[model samples]
Target: MVSITISAAKRTSLAKDLPATLNFPDKTVDTLTVSDVKSAFAAKYPQFYPSRQKISLKGDNKLLADEATLASVGLTDGAELAVKDLGAQISWTTVFVIEYIGPLVVHPLMYHFPSVFYRTTVEHSLLQKYVYAMVMLHFLKREYESLFVHRYSHGTMPFAYVFRNSFHYHVLGGVALAYAAYSPTYANTSSYIVGTIRDDPKFLMGGALVWLWAEVSNLKTHVTLRDLRPAGTKTRAIPYGYGFNKITCPNYFFEIVGWLVVCVMTGSYAAWFFLITGTYMMALWAMKKHRNYKKEFGKAYPKRNIMIPFIW
Candidate 1:
């Protein structure tokens, strides 16, 4: 038997015995999979189940797979597994949908919802749906994109983050944007074609064009990045295309531009605030990615703007 030391980042009821120490049959005699370890773990400590536990090497970001052997992951007689109670695990796509779908469904409802549900009567004009369409496009695109486009080294997220992210995106962002834009006072401007360029035509036409263009660019960039990893390899390479020449994160740039157009089209302070806050958050992430790329590629990578072109 091999004795291993397990340290949990957050203490759980499993600590009823002071410290976490367990012994498993030596793999040479008996092969021990992560599943077997988890089963033994659950049997030892009834508080945690195999599904609720996230077992990893100490100080490592990667989580052990169920079928992985104790020895395959480099765990030996004295190796330490930093265990954590993740409560439950969920797919990134599911988490994102739960977070965004509420807003996507609710924001449009606010436009035509009865006053009984909301404090004031919510109504919209002909052009209001343009902004609504943009909003829906943003979230719906995120859902399909997550499912079909994006890939993560770790496909699951912590349980608490799922609920927290849902609350932030749905309750705070979705409901608030809906309430602000669907209020009794929210009105829309009338428009003509190209001649009256400064009116609703400009807002909807320009916004829709920018939104569509940005969406296309973002998808293409994601595809390019995804292809770099290929079918069975984990190698990563720099992505190029669209605004890649000027920014390491062209996807983020397109994302910001897409929402900025929504804000302009809606002409709502709430929309503006959402766009501003979202852009700021994106900027921070972009800068972080920029630094990461520089560190990763070093002199081989370009010295360019992070998110915005020429003005990051």
Candidate 2:
């Protein structure tokens, strides 16, 4: 038998009483994976589910992958491992659903019930109607993607993030943007006046075309990423084709472009604000994902900008 010491690097109230050691049968030690060690650890401390546990070799900064064999990672008899609690976790699907539901439902209410949102009913112009349709279409596509199309690497996220994400979509993207675009102030803007810049058929048509193009390109990028990993697995493969050739995260790039198109179409300060903030956040995400791809694939990974093409 091979005995391994298990110590809590960061202990929670529930993990304070966990046992200090786990034993592996001699026949299985060479074949046992990090996941097996986690399973054994969870058997003793049920509160630390596999997803919420971060395990590393004792005194080592690098984390152990669940799919890696203990022997392959240089673990042998008397090896010591440290476990850190990741706190409460909620499924990525649940977080996405919650985040999207707010915008999906709130934006329409703001559009249709101006009295409720703006405290008075106001006639919506044709341009406002068009903008509203685009917003609805965008969120609908997102909701669909979250439920059926997108695959997440980590199964769960910290529960606190759900509220932050929801606020960004619901408050900024839905309520604030809707009010700014559909309100009396927007209708009275110089661009909305008849024969003005915003009233030009060519401008509206061009904006619509760009928005549609961005949305479709974003969906294609997402599908390309989805096909890289099979369902029910966290396996990752380098994505190619479509926007992947030029940018690390084409989905984020396309999404930002779509929102920017909306801001142009609507001529709303609130929409522009939402686009700017969303773009900043997406850029951060793209940079992080780019770093991870480079780290994972080294020289084999394609050289590309993080999000923007040609220039980042």
Top candidate by lDDT: 2
Clashes of each: 0, 0
Give the clashing residue pairs of candidate 2, or none. Answer: none
Judging by TM-score against the true structure, name the best candidate. Answer: 2
CA lDDT for candidate 2: 0.84
lDDT of 1 by residue, 1-312 (tens): 777677775677655553477777645313677767777778877777776778888888588887787778877776777777877677777787788788888876776674755565544554566767777787888888877777665556777787777865786569878776656544433332123432355556766888899988888887877777765344667777667888888888888788777666666678788778777788888888788778889999987888878887
lDDT, candidate 2, 57-123, per-residue tens: 8887678888888788887887888888887899998888888787778778877888887798777
Per-candidate local distance difference test: 0.72, 0.84
Sequence-dependent TM-score of model 1: 0.75
